[model samples]
Target: MTLTKQHLVNTFEGARNNNSPYVFVGIEAEGIKEVISIPSVSFDAKEQFYNNAYSNKLVHVMNSKVKIIGLTHGYPEALTDLV
Candidate 1:
């Protein structure tokens, strides 16, 4: 589906109301929209998933216009190979 700025706005609002932890909105240069949901889970699980998504070569090859947003419990100042 093609998503405009308004769609993202609406999605964010809905996610906020639903208490969603992560909402990834991917948009292609051509305007195709892809939404990925990452619910609140253990830190390790979330990190693993995010690491996989971040390292997925297919995503980078598919499109360069990708936007990633994440909401967590607290901001931690730690960086690892998987994270």
Candidate 2:
């Protein structure tokens, strides 16, 4: 099920703060649409996964209707978009 608009904010908060391999931005037509501003995978200080795609694993959680704003990939060209 799609999360309510408010839940989108919560989900985004978690993702933005995450220091994991990848962050999932929750889009509910939300309040601020934040990108991961914190330190990432030792490449750049502000290289967020915004407007991109992730592994097929993410497809499980993202489903079809969900709109992705970022992705982390082994092959950068593999992803359709990158933000």
Candidate 3:
């Protein structure tokens, strides 16, 4: 469902409480949604590839059935490593 600001906040809070490294949250106008969280792990060369692949996959899913409206991040390291 049209991802509202509250959805973003809740998603971010959930991930933050769980100590997640990255999270992708998608929603549709009809209220269908999905939330994927990347676990905390050692950073390596493959990290970039994993991030890009998963992010693309998230976008693809969102584009296919829903509209991505916001991004709320909990991990700061994602700012440096994950795009």
> What is the C-alpha lDDT profile of model 2 across 1-83, one tens digit per residue?
43333333343444455534443343322333333323235323222232133223222244444443443332323233334
Q: lDDT of all predictions, in order shown?
A: 0.40, 0.36, 0.46
Report backbone clashes per prediction: 0, 4, 2
Best by lDDT: 3
What stretches of model 2 exceed 4 Å from their correct place?
A: 24-83
Ranking by lDDT: 3, 1, 2
lDDT of 1 by residue, 7-26 (tens): 44454556556665654443
Residue-level lDDT tens digits of model 3 in 1-83? 44444554465566667777765533334566544344445323223433343333234332444445445445654443223
Quote the lDDT for 48 in model 3: 44
Each candidate: RMSD to true structure?
12.9, 11.8, 10.2
Error of 1 at 13 (Å): 0.3
